[model samples]
Target: MDTHTAATRYIGPTGMDPIFNRIANWLPKLGIDVAGGRLLAVRGRKSGEWRTTLVNVLTTDDGNRYLVAPRGHTQWVRNLRVAGAGEIRLGRKVEAFTATEVADADKIPVLRAYLDRWGWEVGRFFEGVTQDATDAELADIAPGFPVFRLA
Candidate 1:
């Protein structure tokens, strides 16, 4: 499937994924950004229940806010696609907004910035691409990482 199209893909996590994700989910609840994380909540496409997980929110210099899925088309990513909207929450702060996925061709800047600001935490997920990678390199991996602009 062309992830650049509507069919996004996923990169499975290692065994430690659940452990780290669980710990990450706690930091923001305690008002800590141990991973530059926030709680992302979206309605379940099947159950209509709100589902949440820890995610990284990237804000560029120009004031655009985004959510990048290093783990690729995760459950939240699929739900967000179906829901078309979601919430970003810190301890007590919740910002609900609509989201639009960025096309692979246009994800260079967003991907670079996301890696630039957070590679230390998520670099392994990118198959060795880094913040300093060329645009072509980032574009090659763009389709695999779902990015959303928060409005």
Candidate 2:
């Protein structure tokens, strides 16, 4: 199997850090995801619980907000699928939004932008790995990666 596929297979589905709660609490106060982005708080699909995560606020040329899941098929992605739709808190305002799973073909550029924004860590992670993951490969791993927008 290709490196990207292999990595996804190995990671499988895992739980998130407890600290995510702390980050979620502070994100709104700090006005995260507001001007153009916001924090999405969703319920776990199987676990049926709350999970809040910080994600980049991506605005397409047409004026829609999207949250890209670069980590592939992580817990957040699964939770988003289960929750279907959730809430976004921006500054003092909170709004409900629907989560949609975008296909790889349509999401590659956005994924590339996300990796670029997180270059330092992403670069370091792939530093020693012989099988460097291409943007397309990364997208393929979790094809159903979630993208959230205002509902």
Among these predicted structures, which one has the highest lDDT? Answer: 1
TM-score, prediction 2: 0.62
RMSD of 2: 5.2
Any idea how many clashes model 1 has? 0
What is the RMSD of candidate 1? Answer: 2.2
Which tens-of-lDDT digit does each residue in 6-114 have in candidate 2? Answer: 3353233235535654665576658764334456678878777777766566665677667765454567767877778877766777777886766556766655554
Off-target runs (Cα >4 Å) in candidate 1 are 1-8
Model 2 CA deviation exceeding 4 Å by range: 1-25, 29-37, 116-150
lDDT of 1: 0.86
The 10-residue segment with the lowest total lDDT in model 1: 1-10
Q: How many clashes does the backbone of model 2 have?
A: 3
Q: Candidate 2 — worst ten consecutive residues by lDDT sum?
A: 122-131
